[model samples]
Target: MFQKILCIILFCTSFTYAQEHLIVIGGGKRPADALNKLIELSGKEQGEILIIPWASGEQEVGFESIKKDISALSPIKVVSAPFAPLTAESKIVLLNQLKTAKGVFFTGGDQVRIMKVLEDETIFKAMHERYHHNVVFSGTSAGTAIMSEKMITGNGKLDVIDGTQVETKKGLGLLPNVIVDQHFIKRQRENRLMGLILQYPTLLGIGIDENTAVYVQNNKSAEVLGESQVLIFDAEQSKEAMKLYFLKKGDKFDLVKKKKIKI
Candidate 1:
């Protein structure tokens, strides 16, 4: 019995280590510190990083800006992968670019645009495989919203938090058990997030403020970083009303435990 228990423990430990790491940023001006942390996780001094500009209408502008920002941090090579419509040949070519990549970064724009380009493509499959193998995946704004299986379309208004006004679609499904909203505080989007959580109480809600971000590991915890705060709404912990908690820089949250952990 002791030997069997030991084997189970070993398997759990290995599984945790194999899980992907994600850096999700809120919209606005990109925080320098958060970008630096992302680069550090992308193997720093070595390995190449791929930037996907599918979310933006201005692909070249998005590519150059992101490339410049990432290049400013380290000497690592950052290549842009722009998909020209949907084609089998293009999918194979895009997957080939990721063969030697250590990380994948998604720039902000329209989350639906990203889904239209990447969904059911070979490139998406390759990215999912790399994520489990220690490749760092980072996204900002619409990029952050696309990290979850349930993505917010920004179709709702702040006048009220109702299900009828809001809309959600399938995302990348990298982060589980939560719905993420970007530019939370700046945009006064608390109601929208609260509405989603109330409608789907089983899932957690994360409202990330501008100029801030969260470094999420596996499905366990997220460490807050940058100049602002990240609001967490826990439906399971609420009593009669909503349960809300705010986390700032240097703060860490227990995603699965639904509590704050001091770092």
Candidate 2:
């Protein structure tokens, strides 16, 4: 019953933000189709791309990699600005740049670093607005983990499924009700995701394997991409009712209904 109401709420939110979309990569090599989809949904010709590389140690290289990759596919304008030493003038410039951006990409490094850089309420609100109205947000690895409201900090005891063994922090909050984990299969992250979902039953835990992605459209439905799998953990009713779902490349999932869809 509670899960059903959450679904209805999700529908209403998506209806309001009709153009929202997400391309969450699970680290490793990104498939060509995913990159192309990002370019396509971002308005192939007229859209602007913004890359956030603060999470990366070498921000410039990280920024350039995204710019080059997307630019190679399409001649879209790509730009980025550092959040460090946020000057009033620079902040204004960055905010303005965001205003014209149709796609925003985050590089992988430390999810905590990215979240700390985005601590300003104004910046968060701005991103929240653009993301809902007309933006395609994407990321990989640590970038992938930060998509949810509560992010797994890659800490705590790993051998057990205890609630105390997991540590999480505030993330981008783009998918507040869901917990995202990247490089799932490659790193064998079943324990963390399973532990978290079992601990927090109201939220869903999505573990995306390397070379794979879960493309979410209109804030509701998620479709698998690349030649890997996605694991979903849902425990809405209780820990005893917790269910695990496996999805592959071509599978579609209804975020609201919490089930795999044929169409």
Q: Evaluated with TM-score, which candidate comes out highest?
A: 1
lDDT of 2 by residue, 1-263 (tens): 99999999999997876787899999998767788888888888888778888888888988888788787888987888665546778778879988888888888888888888689788888888888887899888888899999999899877887656889999988986899999999999888888888889888899999999999987689999998999999999787768889999999998888988987
Model 1 earns a TM-score of 0.91
Q: Per model, state how many residue pairs clash.
A: 0, 0
Model 2 misplaced stretches (Cα beyond 4 Å): 1-17, 83-85
- Name the candidate that leads on lDDT: 2
Error of 2 at 136 (Å): 1.3
Taking the tens digit of each residue's C-alpha lDDT, what string does model 1 give over 127-187?
7888888888988999999998899988876789774578899888788999999999998
What's each prediction's TM-score?
0.91, 0.90
Q: Tell me model 2's lDDT, rounded to 2 decimals.
A: 0.86
Steric clash count of candidate 2: 0
